[model samples]
Target chain A: MSRIHHLPLHVEFGDCDPAGIVWFPNFFRWFDAGSRRFFVACGVPTWKELEKTTGIIGTPLVDTQARFVRPASYGDEIVVETSIPEWRTKSFVMKHRILRGEELLCECNEVRVFAQRTGADPHAIRAVPIPEDIRALCG
Target chain B: MSRIHHLPLHVEFGDCDPAGIVWFPNFFRWFDAGSRRFFVACGVPTWKELEKTTGIIGTPLVDTQARFVRPASYGDEIVVETSIPEWRTKSFVMKHRILRGEELLCECNEVRVFAQRTGADPHAIRAVPIPEDIRALCG
Candidate 1:
């Protein structure tokens, strides 16, 4: 069974909009944090460490979908539950659920691939095959 | 015919991740900007104005999907093209395409609804029917 990870977040005033609700993009930021937390919970190496050992820069999203069920405001303490449901040859699907106590605030599903820097362009990234060792760690 | 709007943005250094690429979540921030700009380009009143005149606070997204094609970094300037492709009784679909010159960086489709405050809860919002004048303006 794949291990699921949970990351708790404290929403600050900067995370809210003029409407006094959390800005939508901030959820994505938390989701990305959840992704990293999932890997960490699985005892995976940090992306920076992997760059030296495996040439893997990081996992970057190719596609993503999100649904907002309710609005949250500043000072809200939320938890993001993250898990990797499927692993492909070069990609994986990561899912996140943001919640406040028992209330689900938002949910997201993302398709992401392990990436490597291409050539000398520091910004250019190319997808690489899923490393077996990393998969074993996550599993 | 529906009007399309474009919002230009400069990528700041803080918007980049440790990898020096634009963090994926920042695209959603630009998309929200494009959504507001679309209504502005259609000559609709600002959300603050509508709150008093029409009881509409703003358009809040219910669902969203995005595809990231190319990565962008700090110092890059991008433009987001926004348009409404479909309008329902209580919701509409907002589309945004982020581009660097002719290169498409990311694209998003969002299902959003006009919302207003509910009851005594300041942060609670409920969807309202599509306003006729607003529809006419967008169309």
Candidate 2:
């Protein structure tokens, strides 16, 4: 099992929609934050530093599935638990669960790849092989 | 087959990440706007109006899957095409495709429910049966 990283957050009023609940897209934002925090917890360098040293930009999401189990409102305290349960040659699966106390509010599984800029264009990026050293550090 | 609605959008600078690519979560936000536009195109009243008469607040996503195909950036003009492929007793499937000119950028399928406030608490919501009239309008 990989290490699980927990990121605590406080829901702000702006995070809620007119329905007085957190907008669905904001959950994705939190998940992305949790992913980066997980890498930091694993002792991986920031994507900017990695780009300079390894020519690797960052992990970019290719596919994702999310399930919303409960509604969350502004002023609520939440925590995101993130882990990588599987890793492949160029892609990895990141799982994130958002909880309010003991209750699960949402969960997501994202497939992302380590990408490197292929050309001068910023959008020109391609998935690169997972760096073995980084993988070891994460493990 | 349901009526397909298209919503045009212009990508803004703030929508991009440090990588100069559209942040993935913004795609979900556009998909949601496309969903509401789809209903309006079908001649269904806005959720707020519906709530006044039918107690239906809106369609809230329960499950969603998204696949990112190509990267897009600021200044790009995109369109979101939305349609409903299936409807169930208390939930329906909404499909959204994002395209930049002829190239597809991202696609998503979301399972959503018609909800009604169960109590004074905003978080207290429960799925309700699919409204026959609204379904007919969308079809």
Best by lDDT: 2
Docking level of model 1: high
User: What TM-score fits each model?
Assistant: 0.97, 0.98
lDDT, model 2, position A47: 90
Candidate maximizing DockQ: 2
What does candidate 2's lDDT look like per residue over A1-139, in tens digits? 9899999999999998877889999999999999999999999999989999988988999999999999999989999999999999999999999999999999999999998998877679999988999899888
lDDT values of the candidates?
Answer: 0.91, 0.94
- What RMSD, rounded to one decimal, does every model reach? 1.2, 0.8
Chain A TM-score for each candidate, in the given order? 0.96, 0.99
lDDT of 1 by residue, A4-113 (tens): 89898999999988788898999999999999989988888999999998878889899999999999998889999999999999999999999999999999999999
Model 2, range B34-97, lDDT digits (tens) per residue?
9999999889998889989988888889999999998988999999999999999999999999
